[model samples]
Target chain A: MEQKTAIEAFAALAQETRLGVFRLLVQAGPDGLTAGDIAAHIGVPASTLSHHLGILERAGLLRSWRVQRQIYYATDYEGTRRLLAFLMEDCCRGLPELCGTALSDLVACCPKPTVDA
Target chain B: MEQKTAIEAFAALAQETRLGVFRLLVQAGPDGLTAGDIAAHIGVPASTLSHHLGILERAGLLRSWRVQRQIYYATDYEGTRRLLAFLMEDCCRGLPELCGTALSDLVACCPKPTVDA
Candidate 1:
């Protein structure tokens, strides 16, 4: 990710509401979740959720598709991966060993949790 | 890694000068680079570099200490790792295989480069 897009993606994830929404979507995995479902799960009003979704979409952290009347939201996996790589590119310098334990724990703890719509 | 700190860190990295300074620090590794050296490498004026450094420091992306008359700045490896983990917590969902190549490449390409002060 270039600096501009990295900044945008990070900014999108910077907010509390948006961060929760993105985390939920991440946990939802590739199957994704519907707009209504996300709003319900997050306990935010649909109107407010709509605004947060717009920010995430513009930042390229999310992708959406419509199935019938419902809009499904999924984490932009590639975009997120790029952002993560950018952040970790120089992590612990050349001492990967220093960061190894933490890295593995993160990967283990955050395994994709599929959510059915 | 909370919402507030993440926002501040991301905002600090959002700008061109600040980002450049950060990348320089990342490349410089744990041994770090002097403030003057960073300014010279990034081609930003001392006064301007000071401001940018201040932002990175305030955001916790950087740490600094004085060695004689020079102040050395280095990437906060722990802070950076947290940020990266946060971004990648759900990357490629359950398909770590999908992101493995890119992640490894990032690790290889950005190995820490030490600068002698």
Candidate 2:
């Protein structure tokens, strides 16, 4: 998590279209989405979406693979974790208690739905 | 958690100096640091650092308050959480088991230093 790398990751998500794409991919999960599907869901032209995807992949926030002729993209969880670790490195400086709970909640992720009786 | 807001936060941290400043404040913890200290530590001039600080504060990544004559900046944990929540929102879309553990590691900050004989 070098400073330069972190900045690149931040820059990758700084745009509205790119941010939306990343979120969509995150929600899409391990299965990921093909570039065409992503472009369609995001209501952007394929050409435009391709550029954004390239930026994200270069920033290490995304990973892509080809299935036959279609290229799929998924959120790079390891890259994401690295970015988060860099942001929170040395947090509270040996006193995790000061920021642990609040920060930990960030990772709580999708809460389970409750059923009605 | 709005798309625009998330973009703003990402943009705020995309720059080198700003990222350094934010990391410094995160390390500084709740006590924060004065603008002067931040500039000195980051090796940037007061005027330049002031501009970056203003951007980060507006994006909600950092919070600033005045004490007597000096202004202090600290990482806004609430804001950080919000940004992270947005990033991981619907993460795995109800399948927390898919991403929970990995994401949870993000909050495992500030590991205690080991003691040796």
Candidate 3:
């Protein structure tokens, strides 16, 4: 991703409400959550949640699709990966060894959720 | 890093000038670059660069240490790593395999510089 888009993405995430919303969506995975569900989950008013979702959508950090009468929100995983790559592009002077342990730990700790049953 | 600090860091990085300064520092590695040098490299006025640097420093994305009269700036690798990890903690629903290819490509493309000479 270019610097401008990266900045926008970062800006979208640089908020308490938005970050919570984004994280909730990430946890929800590709299945995503409806706008009403997100508002309830984050304990934010519908209007406030709408504003936050708009920011995330504008930043390209999220994607929404209508399933029946509900709009589902999900993380744009590719966009997020691009943003992370851009931020860490020169990480530890490009020496993955310098960042390997941390990256490994992150991966380990962030294991994908199994069946929600 | 906590959410608050992460938000601050993201806010610091959300700007054009500050992001330029931070990326310059990230590229500069542990040796860092002096404020004057950064101003020169990014072609911004000293005063403007100073403001940008101050924002970055306050957000903990950049660290400065004085060596002689020159203040060198470097990326806080740990801080950065923490931020990236936080953002990607639930990436692809914790499926590293989903992010592995992109992550590997990023690491490969960002190899550390061998020597300045």
Better of 2 and 3 by lDDT: 2
TM-score of chain A of 1: 0.79
DockQ of every candidate: 0.22, 0.49, 0.31
Candidate 1 structure quality by residue, lDDT tens digits, A1-117: 677777777778767788889878865666789999999999999999999999998888889999999999987766665666565455444454543454433322112221111
Residue A24 lDDT in model 3?
79
lDDT tens digits, residue span B19-71, model 1: 77887776565778999999889898899999999989988889999999999
Instruction: Give the per-residue lDDT of model 3 (tens digit) for A65-98.
Output: 9989999998887677667656655545554454
TM-score of chain B of 2: 0.86
After superposition, the stretches of candidate 1 with alpha carbons farther than 4 Å from their true spots are A90-117, B88-117
CAPRI quality of model 3: acceptable
Which 10 consecutive residues of model 3 chain A have the lowest summed lDDT? A108-117
User: A41, model 1: CA deviation in Å?
Assistant: 3.2
TM-score of chain A of each: 0.79, 0.87, 0.81
Candidate 1 interface RMSD value? 4.8
Candidate 1: TM-score, chain B only: 0.76
**lDDT, candidate 2, B16-91, per-residue tens:** 9999999888778889999999989999989999999999999999998999999999989878887877786666
